[model samples]
Target: ELSMSGGALRTFSRCVTCLARIGSDLVFQAYPDKLELHTLNSSRSAFASVSLTRDFFDHFHLPADAYADAAPSSTPLQCSVLLKSVLAVLRTPTSAIDRLNASLPNPQASKLEFVIHCVSGRKKTHRISCSAESDVQTLALDRNGFPSRLAIRPRDLTRLLSNFQSSLQELTVIATEPAARLPGVDDGTGGKAVELLSYIDPTKDDYDSRLHTQLWIDPAEEFLEYEHAGDPVDVTFGVKELKGIFNIL
Candidate 1:
């Protein structure tokens, strides 16, 4: 799942290209999502809206004349607009999909679906049939067998874990010198990256500037699957190793 923000066609275009370059399974989002904001001075405030690049660009495309102008910050996003954009992008021209297909392992089999299962004041039990083959690829993210593991009511434990993980990443970035490029490594896309980083504050003076990077390595966990077998579990993050990475070990 990606949580990048932008309001121009170029900005979003670059992000979509990146997501396509990397093998992302699904794009998850919330309606009227609140954004966390911090200025260069590090003070914070928040604004609520339907947040995603696709929604922004589809409605607010950057014209050649307005290429360098600042993007819209005053306009609050519309939920219906986002829904429309989502539908359109899912059915994006096959030629576009094929352009990024080379970067993916099995782009043809990939399915990007919006999960709309609501459990409001209802008791229901969902079931999955056993696989045709006894051994099958079973990928379960945020699997809570019971309610006890949740973070108060419907708030997913996995979402909380992810936010916590993000905090860890920020802390790791803050600690590294020459600045941390340790987390997200640009895929070295043969210089056609479009050079737009999402999650970055474009209003800042450093919009065109490059950065110091960080990349975290998990020897045991591969993409979409952990090497471990059996019930789903949370991995204990290595803080001591993190300390070592920042030279405090």
Candidate 2:
């Protein structure tokens, strides 16, 4: 059982909405110190997780018997629920919500209960059915493993992407040294910059006619932290996933 109020409740709502946009299923892992929510895209190529410490909740509890039979290395109590169903219960505006209390009677329980307290002194209850047999998926990538890293505000990146067509599906990011010149830009200044481009297959019949867009970004000014220790690299990924993550920010 756990209760969240004020800013914590608001954060929880935003996290759920983000997860809903990423996948069809929401996985919940409850531990003694924190609560974690995760989701994996249908293709299993993308995974996202949000962890909230005990301090984030107004009240949190874990029964001693929740995992009594498990070894010390056993996993936490985990369950999966339909993202749409969870979203339905959390769709209420955060301003109208004063508090949210969630409870799972036991590991064998088939339903998760949520009680919402509104500022008007009104209470609303919702029960979302969940399954405990669903397989858990996790990723083990290390952040330090990447030779290049950049930290930029979400709004900054989102504004840059706005230049592309709304229907654009993929985006390519090219990182290069300060002396390296980008495709179209001929500015002589040897300044560090990152290139963002809308990508479509070159072999497509309408390739030449399709809109081509690119944006040059000065990393020194836009990124809070930028580091590249290897050769130039370009990565392409779905823009829809990025928009989903930016929405929460």
TM-scores for the candidates: 0.19, 0.82
Error of 2 at 126 (Å): 2.3
TM-score of candidate 1 relative to the true fold: 0.19
| Predictions in order: lDDT | 0.26, 0.83
Which portions of model 1 miss their true places by more than 4 Å?
1-7, 33-249
Clashing pairs in 2: none
Model 1, 100-136: lDDT tens per residue? 1101112122322222212232222222121121110
Q: How close is candidate 2 to the true structure, as a TM-score?
A: 0.82
When summed lDDT is taken over every stretch of 10 residues in candidate 2, the lowest stretch is: 131-140
Least accurate 10 contiguous residues by lDDT in model 1: 37-46
Q: Cα miss at 244, model 2 (Å)? A: 1.8
